[model samples]
Target: MFSTSIRFSADCVDDHVWLGDLEAAENTFMLDKLNITHILTILDYKPVYNKDDKRIRLYIEAEDIGSYDLLSSFETCYHFIENAVQNNHNILIHCQAGISRSATIVAMYFMKKYTLTHEEAIEKLSNKRCYHMVCPNNGFQSQLQLYHQMNYAVDKTHELYKDFQSERLRTNYGLEKSDKITKTEKEIIDDTDRFPIKSEEKTLETEEVEYQCKTCQHKLFTRNDLFYHQQGRGKSDWSTKPLELDETICDKQVFTYYTDWMIDVFDSNVGDIHCISCQTKLGEYSLDGKKCECGHWVMPAFHFDQNQIERHNEMNHNHVEKS
Candidate 1:
């Protein structure tokens, strides 16, 4: 009842039948002449269409999955094979060459159903199916590596990638706010508890802390100093606001106080800054680095590292002024 056959030989077993090419004609002729009734077609990639026959069921296999998003596509094909196997349905699995992708899936089946290691299962499939089938480079190597490490490693390396992704996001520029604003259950509960107050309360209810105007040249850091500067009460180190502002006001006075708010909240210079544009860099940049002060799209935050902030400011100075 069991029989093995290679009805048609291909020029290069890189993938499934080149269905429309010259070789496809040869393969189709062979399939017709041989009366291939119960073929288990194994394809490494997409198969070429031959003469229309609803009777023949085909199974396709991809050589290498490029990324996590691709895993679902391969899993769907694998699930189809599983269902066919359960129903005792004859199938065909083909790749561009029948070497890597087809062989990998067969190997996976052996591992999943028979509890074989990747090496052992691959060896078994190559021996029984096609000895030439090998794990060649493309994207399959990374996929197989992921599979292998997940299968055998003491701690799953896949989880490590997940953790690394989280860390990358956490450390990326201007993402400190993003780190603080997460969607965890505990955080959700805390946010929910503060919902009504958050929604309604505009004025921040906080114990008065000494905070000087960040916009001014002198490094003042107290509320009393800030009040003194505002009132023009004592000898001010920095320039004082002009008492008269009927119509002779310059841009400096108007922009000074707003500048303080910007420095406190979104100053790229203050904190660690990643390129808010790319969200790829680590650490902080200047407050001017915030929003790229130029026209370039960027995020701003307090606590940005001085270097990045300065760099961003220098790079985008022209555009920042326009913005």
Candidate 2:
């Protein structure tokens, strides 16, 4: 139990930065002795402190499980830690076990300050402790790697972030099988994310262009709903070997980012998609995702046969918008 002191002799991983379990936080004696003026807690539940305490406290509710997205808290945590360090104030970061969640944040701070990849940050942190103390699970490890690609800031609009969120939601759905999940979990899973849909009747501004069923001209999707990918190059259009796509471009599939209609087919691993208006078999979708022939991978890939659907553009959105 945290009631017993588990505070290490030296939990400081960087200048004015310390890492440990809850003991480093709840033990008032340690806080006073170490001159800790700021506290950051990342766990499944919030911890309590004295009301009259002068120190600053930031609480982020995140489980330590592999699927939970600690990535979302990167920016907020970094800001809090940086502010304390700038003021020359000592701060302690802690989680339930201090193995995954707390360690991940400390690594993130080093990643920003030193411009290091997550692995390098972990190595630096380990050297500071004189042992191997940093170990985030596979899921968090993947998120940290992505954080490196994102340059240590959360870019919700980036293709990789979008893909990460989609996969996270899908994974949550699989793990959380009960009908009555928490409201937070429900909102997180049901959200349309970047599209910002209030209802299914109205479309989004981002997706002005549309794809229609060729046989009956039934309305399908806007360009915004589509998932654009890096085209592959092959000496010939149908060559088996993977390479960059050339001028002789032949795209055989159309992919969607997300749609309300897909909820039914995606209950399992794979499902077929038929046109809503004419009931014509347009294509198929897979929750497991598939790689395009052009050598790009799409997680939870929703693919429509190019021959079965016709493109209609309102804005001719050839270039993707980045915010």
lDDT of 1 by residue, 1-323 (tens): 11133445422221221111223223545545544332334444444454565445545433244321222234445565566656655434445555555555555555556666777766666555452445634444444444555563323225643443233334443232211222442343333322111112222222222222222322222211110011122222223432321321111111111122122223113553233234433334342333222122222323222222211111222221221
Candidate 2 residue runs with Cα over 4 Å from true position: 1-10, 174-323
Q: Which ten residues in a row have the lowest lDDT in candidate 1?
A: 248-257
lDDT of each: 0.35, 0.71
- Scored by lDDT, the top model is 2
- TM-score for each predicted model, relative to the true structure: 0.37, 0.55
Worst 10 residues of 2 by lDDT: 192-201
Q: lDDT for model 1, please.
A: 0.35
Rate residue 276 of model 1 by lDDT.
29
Q: What is the Cα-based lDDT of residue 80 in candidate 1? A: 56
Per-residue C-alpha lDDT of model 2 across residues 1-323, encoded as one tens digit per residue: 22334455337898999987776677776777788899999988877666777889999888888878788889999999999999999999988767788888998999999999999998888778664366877788888999999978888767788677667766764422223435543343244332222222433335454678889987777644655454665454334655565433224456776565444333234677888677788888776667776655566677888778865545653534323
What's the TM for model 2? 0.55
